[model samples]
Target: MSDKETPEQRRERLRQEEIKNNIGGNLNDSINKSNNGNLVDLVGSLGWKGTGILIIVIILGYIIYSLFFS
Candidate 1:
């Protein structure tokens, strides 16, 4: 199969590629910052583990409240 892109299609593809590269670069920068002892790095580094713990604590608190009061 032969595939050819029109000029407009090529331009759009390049634009999309640039956008993806920019986002990836920004993410890398944030990770690097976090690795260098920045407090904001805590969030970037811990990420889902921190988020999961927070959710679990909240759920447990809610359950305890319901069990004790109602």
Candidate 2:
């Protein structure tokens, strides 16, 4: 269909085009590509709340194992 686009749709289409045309605006050229990994990036990506929950789950698993199997 060749119907005229609304203003909002035109603005959104233009914004998408702008974003698509902008290359390497947030590219990290210095990042390591291998999976050897960095703990800081891993923990930071998870945020404090997620890290805390992970720690809690690990501690509970350890406690359960110690109480039941040892």
Candidate 3:
């Protein structure tokens, strides 16, 4: 088989590749925005004191659980 593509085929391939890249970029941007929004809401709700308490509780719970169960 010939390993050469026609001009029309090459143009079509490049166009399709461009479209694929654009769609992937747009999807990634949207996902990043969504994740950032969730993070913002979580931080806002927890504030500083709540976050600190949560971390301490989680660490203590982990230690207790590991000691008792695993």
Candidate No. with top TM-score: 2
Local error of candidate 1 at residue 17 (angstroms): 25
Q: State the weakest 10-residue window (summed lDDT) of model 1.
A: 42-51
Rank list by TM-score: 2, 3, 1
* CA-lDDT, candidates in order: 0.62, 0.54, 0.60
Error of 2 at 25 (Å): 23
TM-scores for candidates 1 onward, in order:
0.36, 0.45, 0.41
Question: Which regions of candidate 1 deviate over 4 angstroms?
Answer: 1-46
Native-vs-model 1 lDDT?
Answer: 0.62
Give a tens-digit lDDT track for model 2, residues 4-69: 888888876775455445423312311232145575654444445545765898899999999999
**lDDT leader:** 1
Tens-digit lDDT track of model 1 for 1-70: 1168788888767755654456545455555666676756644443455546656987999999999999
Alpha carbon deviation, residue 29, candidate 1 (Å): 19
- In model 2, the clashing pairs are none
